[model samples]
Target: MCGFWRRYFFLKTLRGLRVLAYSPVTRPTIVPFDDFVLQEMMYAYKHPDTIKTDDEWIRWIFRLRRRERRHALEFVEGWSGTRIAIAGTTPWLASCLVGIIWSAARGNIQTAFTVAGFILTSSTVILAVLAIISSVESSNRAVT
Candidate 1:
């Protein structure tokens, strides 16, 4: 009898917590997946440089092989750095999103407010470094 009463009281307390935590709000607006996909496809197709025909793909493949040969001959080619910048940005964006969600769940207004700013700052710094490196490389090529 004592064990059963203890368990019942614990469950009742948990039920009260659920009631206290209840948030009654209207449903959030959701974007239709089809419409979102359509928008992305349209945007990608609208870019002339990104749109590829079969012949264009073949030509691009050949061009890539030619560039590879040239790089081998030169032996001075270096990293593109775009991938590095993108890598840095990817984690920052993911962290910012997670932080936002965490702060929302915990109701931490300060954390939610500052997380995005910090992420943006790091992203900007990474992009700036990548841009400076690329620009220096381009300038060196022009000088040589």
Candidate 2:
């Protein structure tokens, strides 16, 4: 009778644990044990199912690879365009800055801080434009 009662309590506790494990509200936040992932992988590789997974796995891998390649190409394109635009425009901007700084240099002979401030402000704008272009390209979005 004692053994039977102990077994019954043990089973009841396990049943409760199973219920709690699957409950959305009461489910554990973390796994408490290692599932021996490598062992399962070795077993799966050794034991081929009637429904082959190799082809499916290969297709999935290829799909992911293509997606990554596409992202990389888009990133290069966006940056290349942004870089060309900035390069083409920067010469004019630099000349303008130099003229402004030269005038300031005549005034106080102290144009270092003014040049630094202008450079910093312009660099921030360029970086923001680059980021926006990259994000738009990656998302395949058109800016209206």
Candidate 3:
């Protein structure tokens, strides 16, 4: 519950700041996380232009990796809407499932059914919205 609220408010803050301005019509290219780390390390360690005799090697490597991650995240901001929606709803869904199970264990079939119906309805709505967003984004990209 705490995590959900934190994430929700964090996203809300970002939206308020308009920090998520760029919305690509397609998902950004995904570089595997480990691969990106390894590549960044190699570039930082072996690239003569960045090598130094000081103890700043760790700082340099972290700075370079952070910058790359920032760019990747920026490029992937278009998927944030769907991602945020799913993330925000996941905890509620899980809790509902738990509640339904508990109700069934107590032989409250009616309660279980009611919760199940709500879950099904909410899930359908969420999925439909995601589908519509995906189709619209794809069509927009095609038009451009």
lDDT of 2 by residue, 1-144 (tens): 236633321211111111011233342233232456434433444455843655864564355453213211111112345444665466557756775687677764346546655765776676567556545544564332
- Candidate 3 regions off by >4 Å? 1-100
Assess every candidate by TM-score: 0.34, 0.26, 0.33
**Could you tell me the lDDT of residue 84 within candidate 1?**
53
After best superposition, candidate 3 residue 28: deviation in angstroms?
A: 23
Which model, 1 or 3, shows the larger TM-score? Answer: 1
Candidate 3's displacement at residue 70, Å, is 32
Assess the local accuracy of residue 104 in candidate 3 as a C-alpha lDDT between 0 and 100: 65
Candidate 1 lDDT by residue in tens digits, 27-119: 223323365554544454345467656475356435535321321111123343555555556757776786778687989868875776777
Q: Top model by lDDT, which number? A: 3
Q: What local lDDT does model 1 show for residue 87?
A: 52
Write candidate 3's Cα lDDT for 43-91 as tens digits: 6544647756666765643553642233223222133565657755775
The lDDT per prediction is: 0.48, 0.44, 0.51
Greater-lDDT candidate between 1 and 3: 3
Superposed by TM-score, candidate 1 places the C-alpha of residue 125 at a distance from the truth, in angstroms, of 1.3
lDDT of 1 at 34: 64
Instruction: Please give me the total number of clashing residue pairs in predicted model 1.
Output: 0
